[model samples]
Target: MPDRRDLDIGELMTAFDAVVRANASLMTQLSSRAGVHDTALRALVLVSDTGYSTPTEVAGFLGLTSG
Candidate 1:
């Protein structure tokens, strides 16, 4: 049988509120360790997903600059 504690964690992780909270907590921890602003991590994630993006494009999409 699946461990009850593991099942509880899985259910909690699947919850939208739990997922968002967990993501925010992890991002905070990661940004602190990486020595970069949280927005920088967000921008990196956005840039990595789009192969054809440029700096201007990314800035515009990220609202860091006027499009």
Candidate 2:
């Protein structure tokens, strides 16, 4: 295979920064909503961050049960 040396660190950093900023904005909005405590918000964040999770796993981590 030909040498693959094609990647832009600057662009990657920019995209990462944008994602971080957007996540922060959404987190603030969600936190302001009623009936949502820190634990719930954290569970949501963890699920979103990890991209996929089972209810049992999340519940176990959050000290909740899969109902």
Query: lDDT: which candidate is best?
Result: 1
RMSD of candidate 2 to the true fold?
7.5
Kindly list the per-residue Cα lDDT of model 1 for residues 1-67, writing each as its tens digit: 9999999988876897877889889888898899998778867877788757788877887688854
| Structure candidate 2, residue pairs in collision | none
Candidate 1 pairs with clashing backbones: none
**lDDT (Cα, tens digit) per residue for candidate 2, span 20-52:** 899867776777784687578978878999999
lDDT of 1: 0.82
Off by over 4 Å in 1: 1-14, 54-67
Question: In terms of TM-score, how similar is model 1 to the real structure?
Answer: 0.57
